[model samples]
Every structure is written in structure tokens, then in C-alpha cells.
Target: MNENKFIQLLKKGDEKAFETLYNEYASKIYGLLRSYLKEDEIEDALQDVYVRIYRGIKGFKQRSKLSTWIYKITVNTAKNYLKKQKKNYLSLDFNLEKNKFTSKENVEKDVFDEIDYEFILNSIEKLPPLDKTIIKLRDIEGLSYYEISKIIDKPVGTVKSRLHYSRKKLQKIIEEDQNEGNG
Candidate 1:
């Protein structure tokens, strides 16, 4: 079924449509929540996000894609969760499970790649929340600048510049870490 029709069903409080929507978006929203929340908080936050989505579906205007609207809701819910928890910092818990490589050469390469990837994620976790979020939305989640702008409620230009600046900052952090490790 088309998303519009699916959304209409959601608005009408159809249980099957709600189930389909949950199946489709739960994991993606959970992953997005992980970027903003802690392990203990994730399950609760995910529930809260879906609850809000279910209740707010009737008010959803089609100015954005359903995915984008869902993402925006998730971000807001995460921020609200953080505020409610009295936490001053947002942490990125990106799941970078190591891939199994078959050949010896591939195994060696993948080990080094995982090491570097882990290092970068550690560095990114040290960044301010907004920068971390932009980096995650753009690089990890593969969201477009426009989509990110809507999700974060910023202009497209702001999202682009923040993403650029965040990338540069992450690069500098990685370089510093490398230099210190070498030294």
C-alpha cells in the first residue's frame, strides 16, 4: 500500500496499520535513539517515540515524508528524554559490529579497519551533542541535508555547514589521537 494510504489508516487508528508502521520503523528509530540515549534509556525512549507517533499521527501534515516526520519526532523525544533525565551531555553509541572476513588477508585488513573506525567513533562521542547528531544523521544514517534540516529543524545551509564543520573537527580529533599514539 502507498504511504499516504498507510498514513491515512494510521490516522484512523487502524491496529493493523499501526503494527505495520511499528515493524517498518522500530529498528531504524531505535538505532537513531541509540545515538542520543544510553543503553538503559533506549527501550523507554523508543516506546515514548512510538507512543507520540501513534497519538500524533492524526495531526501529521504531509509537508515532509513519513520517515522524515518520524525522525523529527524521534529526535525531539530523545532530547526531551535527556532533559527529563537531567543529563547535560548526549553520547553517540554507534553499533559498529565487526564483520567476519574469510581470508587471512581480509581478516588483517578488517581488523585494522575496525580499529580505525572504533577510534573515530570514540572521537566523535567526545563532540558536542549537535555536532555529533549532524555527523550521525549525515554520515552514519545517510540522510540528505534537506532531510536532516527537517529532522533537526534547521535550514539546509545550516545542516551542510554543520556537517562540514563536524567532519573537519572529527578529522582534527583523529589526527591528534594518531599523533599522540605515535609519540
Candidate 2:
């Protein structure tokens, strides 16, 4: 069945619809939560999202598409989880400028000096929240600008511009690593 049919079943509280929805979006939801939450917190947050969907499905009003609403819920839920952790733990708004690596200055043990996909992901981890989300949604998740606009509740033009800027920022970070290597 199509998304609308599944949503109709979900609205009616059909258990089968829940299973179908879970089977379809489980990996996407898990990937999203994994990007933003700890491993232990993932399942809890995922459960919370579904609970919110169940209770709020009636009042959804269709202002946005179902998946967009789900994506927004996922992002909000993850943010709430992080906020609770911020009280006694690390500050999430970490500074990337302080962590820039210089290969020439720190070459004592060259075993771990190689730059690769995981290295790039580490650099992405240091970006601001919006930039990180924008890059992930556009590049990693492969969502289109229109869908991303709905998911983020931003104007389509704004989504396009931010996506462009996000990719540029990532590219610049990559270039920094290259220049550091060349130096």
C-alpha cells in the first residue's frame, strides 16, 4: 500500500499499519537517531516518536506531509534527548576552530594520520547543529530540496541556499585537511 493508505491505517490505530510503518521507516529513523543520540538512547527515543505519532495523529491537520511531520518529530525528539544530557555532561555546541589538526606540527606517530571517510565524518561532527543536519539530510539521506524544506519547515529557497552553504562549508573543511596535509 501507499503512504497515505498506511497513514490511514495508522490513524485508525491498526496494529498492522504500525508494523508496516516500522518495517518501512525503521532504518531511516534509526539512522537519524544514531546520528544525533547515544546508542542506549536510540530505542527510547524511537519509542517516544511513535507514541507521539499515535497520540498526535488525529490532530495532524495535514499542514505538512506525514513523513515530514515524522521527520520533524524525530529531530525534535532527538534534540530533547540531547538537552537532558547537556545538564551535567558535554556541551553540544562544541568549537571546531579549536580542534583543527596540523599534520606538519604533530607528526610524531604517523600511524593514524591518514584522512578517510571516517575522518571526514569526525570533521562533520564538529559543525553546528543546523549545518550538521543540513549536510546529513541533503547529502547522506539524499532528500530533495522540496522535501527537506518541508522536513525543516523552511522556505524551499532557504533550503536550497542552506544546502548549498552547508556543502560549501563541508568542502572547505575537507580542503583544510588537504592543505594541512600538503603543508
**Candidates' lDDT values, in order?**
0.79, 0.68
- Candidate 2 lands at a TM-score of 0.71
- Candidate that would win on lDDT: 1
Per-residue error at 88 for model 2, in Å? 10
Report the number of clashing residue pairs per model: 0, 0
The CA lDDT at 34 in model 2 is: 66
Clashing pairs in 1: none
Predicted candidate 2 versus true structure: per-residue lDDT over 69-129, tens digit per residue: 8888888888789888773121122222222222221221142245465666666766666
Candidate 1 local accuracy as lDDT? 0.79
Model 1, residue 179: distance off in Å is 2.9
Clashes of 2: 0
Candidate 2 regions exceeding 4 Å error are 87-120, 179-183
Q: What is the lDDT of residue 23 in candidate 2?
A: 76
Per-residue lDDT, model 1, residue 6, is 94
**Global lDDT of model 2:** 0.68
